[model samples]
Target chain A: MPDKEKFFEQIVRENRDKLYRICRACLADPDDAKDLYQEVLVKVWLHLHTFRGEAKLSTWLYRIALNTAILYRKQQNKHTPLLPQHISELPDASAETAHKQEQEVLLQKLHYCISCLEKQDRLIISLVLEEVSYKEIAEVLGLTVSHVGVKINRVKQKLALLMEQQAGAEIELDKADKR
Target chain B: MNFEEIQKNWQTQQAPAAEAKAGGATAESDLLVRVKVLQRKVMRTNLLVAIVISLTAVAFVFILRPLLNPNTIWYDVGMGLTLGAAFALGLLHWFKSMPWKKQVNLSSKAYVEQVLKKLHYLNTANQRLTPFFMVAILAGINLIYFDIFWNENIKLRLVMHIMLNAFMISVGAISLYYSKRHNDQSYEPIIQELEELQQKLEEV
Candidate 1:
């Protein structure tokens, strides 16, 4: 009802998916991602007053979510899972078509490949996937726009290679299964 | 899957579906309450600590002094020790409140850099502050019985002073060693991580 509560709710509702996805992108564990998201929210609420309307709220939220994840995962170095163990379930998989199922598999592979890149690269690509502009990504990451462009190119190439390797491995497994 | 295609799918994907997704209005209200409660709790605890410290200092200076009838220099030593302790607590308080600084709005690299600076400053300040206080307090304690004992047996007073000083020095030195070790152990990993992040962002 109060102004602060209204502002907090609005911000959370608006950026809920973005924050959750950022957490997911950076951390390999869903539980850890959830924890990181909560920590980010706690920070946002605590530091709500410090928001001086300088940066867009989403950009500010991105900075907080990401900075928290980097620092939080610094303490959780041992929890890294080398697989795409994070892709638990496709949303409403049973109701979707076979084409949708194939898309889900590719999405799974994408998650796996994203998990394989460097931590900062993973975060940058997540923002890039969200259609965030290079300038905003640079701002969120404290990088030059040109550097973001450079890193995105590199990460995208790496991700593509990783995905190709992953898909090739999957096809081999399928052939073996057929044999 | 092509990069452009995956990028498109990423946008259309329904959700990673965070586990904390509780019912809408109720859950948000609960979170708001929890955050507010936590903020209030920290403030209350800090206030209580400050009050208790003030009360103890007052009781020591006013009540204990008149009751014991010690030398005037003894009171000065007590005052010095109190001020030393207050100074340490003040620095710690500042450290706890460091996050509220206006730098939060800075970009992530600048934010991490600033945090690293503060952490390094806190570490160095702690390393320097501890020994400085140890020496100051040790001097104060060593001075305490001096005016009284100095007037009497010079050898006995010298022996007592040396014993007390030796005890204070040994205790202070051991604690200082452990304190510095603890600080490094706790701060080093975080500092290392922040440095790595800084480098990652700084790299082209």
Candidate 2:
């Protein structure tokens, strides 16, 4: 119950989910997303001393997450899978409700498409998906607001095209199965 | 699905239900323990570096005092220069690491540049300081040979000198080759990746 631990706990409570989403959007593997999430938290804790309210806390958090994700190199042997190893894990689709299953599928496809984008674009669109404002995304990415808009448009268009291609492939597979 | 639908789905999905590790439950305790382990590893790396530096200083102290005729003033100066070069090599790490520590707070563009800067520093340090350090050490050893072999048979001195210099030069060359190879295998790809990220960041 020290001050730093308390502060870390509160920040994690508020932002861990969104941070994980950013990781999930950037990396296709669920395990890698969790690993990236832990890496981001470690960095967040390390840099907590530097936070001076210069930017919104979530913006700061997203900056850390995206930076880590951009440069994160996966170590296969050293990965200690993060805790709460439950079935609700996104890629492990054993026990979800119907709507949950559908959402998971869509999210997985979205992750695949996100992974296919360029690295910075992945971070940009991930922030966009998190409902971060264009101005804030601009600030986090060190770009002008108009630049953020332009990039977001290009990323969205690319994402839509990728998702459509994925849907087409899925439909083609279904037709082949029926045949 | 439309982009808005995809955005809604992203927002609606729960990120693998797990609470904050505050209640001291199994996962809560486990995660905190992992973080502690990671923090401990970082501490251990720092400790190891300090130990190596202290040991290097101790080794230089031993080298400066013994195995050469202390009566010769030039020999003493040669050893001093060698130790200075070694210390300089050690201090070069500070150049590579100071910016890395501050990069956690930077924006993405700045962070990418910081990473590239660190890697470029690595290659530059390897190219320049490795030769400088090895040559200083070799020069020191060669200079001390004058006093040590002053009374030895001339043939023995000449052959031994040639052999030692040849050995040292070969070792230095092999190390430089491997250092370059190491940089290429590791830091080069990272530099390329960062540069590409930087370009992507600026593409708009």
Candidate 3:
């Protein structure tokens, strides 16, 4: 109906950031995150016409990004000798050399915590992190708003416990270095 | 800071702010490129398979149907194969040229799901024609064997007919059994994967 090329370019330009952030959320390493981000963009470009406008564009985008990441993860698991660098390649953590080590430490813990979540919980966190409304997140994720709220609270608590444990480990390592 | 506080801060500043540099290429970009390449490759493979299978099927039809009758010629076989190939190739081209690219979206899940569905439909259609395939092969074999038997002026016609019938029945039975078994196992994985894909979509 619309000029196909123009419509696709507009959708890509408009939603690129959100898509990129979701990619970063799913992937651990920055390089891998960036790679996943671009992949999502290309997919969005190719699939933009299917948008149908039934849900918010963000929800639709989330659907695509999450599915792609999960498929990629599933595929990676099938191969032997998972790449070591994959864990450290997160985009935000890898961007600055000075903060890279600390950011990586924090991200590694975050990664483990997120991975432990149920698929629905992971969707909630990704959406919440992207600053989507609780209602919108529910709509995008096909959950009740109350259910989303409760899940978000539970995930937040779980993440807190995980971060605390990582913090304790860091303190122990600091003490050993001092000794 | 507590994780909640840090996460809240992180969320507030998350994505919309970085919209300015949306055009730049990043490492994540590479993964996307690879995915596109793979998608195209899969599409090509599917087209090739459809063409080859259709040609083989049509060729089988021509060879078997005319063997009992004297009207068909060897050239009919070649013509049938060519026509089947051209028809299948045309359908493949139509699908490829369709704006399937615009429907791919952020995950490529929808497109992949469509591709899987197409494959399943093809398999089912192919399976439905399988009985015809078996009958045609047997008919063709009988005609050729009859020609040879007639040419040799071979006697014991009762024994030859009985043996040929038994052999055809046995072969048909074996093929049907294996076909059912293979189809069940193959379809299970695809159905399971499609279910998983649906679950993932709902979660999204």
Candidate 4:
């Protein structure tokens, strides 16, 4: 393979998971997330030569991924269905061991809470959870670093409250089952 | 669970398998093809619209000659200006919409700067062409009226001429104002953002 192709493959391999996670966080539907992932990859490949070494490659990748994902969401919204689809049905848990199944359920709940967030806040918190630095996140999002810090704190608190409410609801259901 | 625990879980989730083969070479090419196809579609639509409008203007100038003296200077000038403006506007639209080759070899910052430059050029072109187009069409219409009405009953011709001029002027002014406002609203923010991005790239 040519040197350019090899370099491109290496980047993809290293950051595929990060890109996938960003897509999944931004899009509620699994299929839409996958489509967005592919779209981002194609864009990255097409624009790879333009990478100027100005921003870190990973930061550039995040910039592309987030922008593509956000645009995809906007396009989807214009054609939004009368009934919003359920957070894409999680993969069947029956195949997993009990502990793994529990983890999957928790992850699904987490994703549900994320889906409830206002669009920009969802992206901010998703990057926060992904361990992207405040400065890089601000750069990707075109916000001030200080603003990113404040927004992240607010989003985190919101998520905590959501999780608590979900947990409370689950316990109440358990009590009903016991009765 | 707390935010930290959620972050840990998020990190542990498996990434999906790579769906495209070999650095997405096929997918990238597919996208390029789609873009080309869309560009062609736009060009076709623009050409069709241009042809139709040009033909209509031409026909209007020729078919209306029985109402005006063909030998009159105003009639000739009016037809010439109307056709010229119509064709120029069509040509301008074509130039603006046609796809240029992508400058893939340039660095990202340079590429963005190039795009910004092109956008600025287009905006400038539209701004300059718009007034000329407005004036040309307005002159054409007024001249055509002058040819047909200049020899008619004096009082009736005067009333009709004044009314037509007032109506066209109001429409032209309103249109020019809105076109400028619309362009500023649509392109100014994008231009500002790109400039900021270019600056950030340079600083880095």
The numbered model that scores best in lDDT is: 4
Off by over 4 Å in 2: A73-94, B20-204
Q: Kindly list the per-residue Cα lDDT of model 4 for residues B1-204, writing each as its tens digit.
A: 567888988987755656443334333434344434444654686689688987887677677675444647888788788778978888887876653444233333444577577568767977888788878988897888887777678898788879988998899889889978966876666667667656744553
Which digits, one per residue and each the tens of the lDDT, describe model 1 over residues A30-132?
A: 6666656655766676678889989988899999888888877766655464474444456676799988887777767776777778888989988988889
How well does candidate 1 reproduce the true complex, by DockQ? 0.10
Whose DockQ is higher: candidate 2's or candidate 3's? 2
B6-111, model 3: which lDDT tens digit per residue?
Answer: 5654443234324432332221233334335534654675678577767766655676446544343533443444444445544644464344455444333454
Deviation (Å) of A37 in candidate 1: 1.8
On residues A1-179, what C-alpha lDDT tens digit does candidate 3 reach at each position? 24754665566677776676666666655455565665566556556668888887778888888877776666545223223334445666445685555555565556655655565566577777766888987777678999889988897787677667766766787799899
* Winning model by TM-score: 1
lDDT of 1: 0.70
Q: In model 3, what lDDT does residue A177 have? A: 85
Candidate 2 per-residue lDDT over residues B1-204, each given as its tens digit: 677788899987555545632232222223334424433443464457557866865764686457443656766676677667766766675555555444253334455566566667767887877797889888877766755676789998898789889999999889889978967865676566567656744441
Could you estimate the TM-score for every candidate?
0.56, 0.51, 0.48, 0.54
- The residue pairs in collision within model 2 are none
* Candidate 4 docking class: incorrect
Docking quality tier of model 2: incorrect
In candidate 1, which residue pairs clash?
none
